[model samples]
Target: MMMNKMREIYGVVNMILFPEDEDPEMLSLELFSSFAKAKERSEEIIKEFIDDYGEDYIEHVTKKNPVAVMGNGDVTGYVYIVKTHAL
Candidate 1:
């Protein structure tokens, strides 16, 4: 049998890819935010999007957006969420 070269479909992404010690299906490169903090951020950021755009802003932008990052996370580089139908 011949060996094929492995490809980095996600590219040289700086963030941790999925199938990790935690959630294997998808590696969450985002820093864990407290409930209150998340709520505040949602209000500050998404509220504006909803007002400027519409209530469907989150639904439209998040559906298969393939990324979730935080400016405060260690994933301080070009982070990317790899797409996969399998685990």
Candidate 2:
């Protein structure tokens, strides 16, 4: 008998701001097998946004969703950090 193994996947969600548009663009930027790497990438993105627009213009959002099963039978639930304009 063989047992199935479960693993966690980490991802970053980016909200790109447009000066001319009222709505920001949202998308998944990257995926990682380790949370540390995902978090580092999120920080990098935040820093870039701050460097370009200033801290007052950037907002951080976090969301946690329920676990989802992929088509290949891999289960994943993401806790993502998003960068967007300050509201």
Candidate 3:
């Protein structure tokens, strides 16, 4: 038998770094279970990025989303999610 599961909260980090005239290099990192966890990880990522690429290059945003995921142990499902304003 299948049952509905509680919606999961996820945090996403998006970043773009490059000169205006050049192509933007963007990275999307996801898979965190909570906003705090996501933010914490993003901070670490930001530090590393800044150290390697410099603070001047980064355009950063953290997106918090609540996702309704449907599935069974067999792995068939759909994900419905909404994105909240960036922080």
Provide the overall lDDT of each model, using Cα atoms, as 2-decimal numbers.
0.47, 0.45, 0.43
Of candidate 2, the 10-residue stretch with the lowest lDDT total is 4-13
Segments in model 3 whose C-alpha atoms lie over 4 Å from true places: 1-33, 59-87
**Top candidate by TM-score:** 2
lDDT head-to-head 1 vs 2, winner:
1
Q: Relative to the unseen true structure, what is the C-alpha lDDT of residue 4 in candidate 3, on a scale of 0 to 100?
A: 18
Off by over 4 Å in 1: 1-38, 68-87
Give the TM-score ranking, best first.
2, 1, 3
RMSD of each: 16.9, 17.8, 20.4
Candidate 2 stretches with Cα past 4 Å from truth are 1-33, 59-87
Q: Give every collision pair in model 2.
A: none
TM agreement with the true structure for every prediction: 0.30, 0.31, 0.29
lDDT (Cα, tens digit) per residue for candidate 1, span 1-87:
122112223321322453334542223223323556787986898578678668775565556445545577555444334243443
Better of 2 and 3 by TM-score: 2
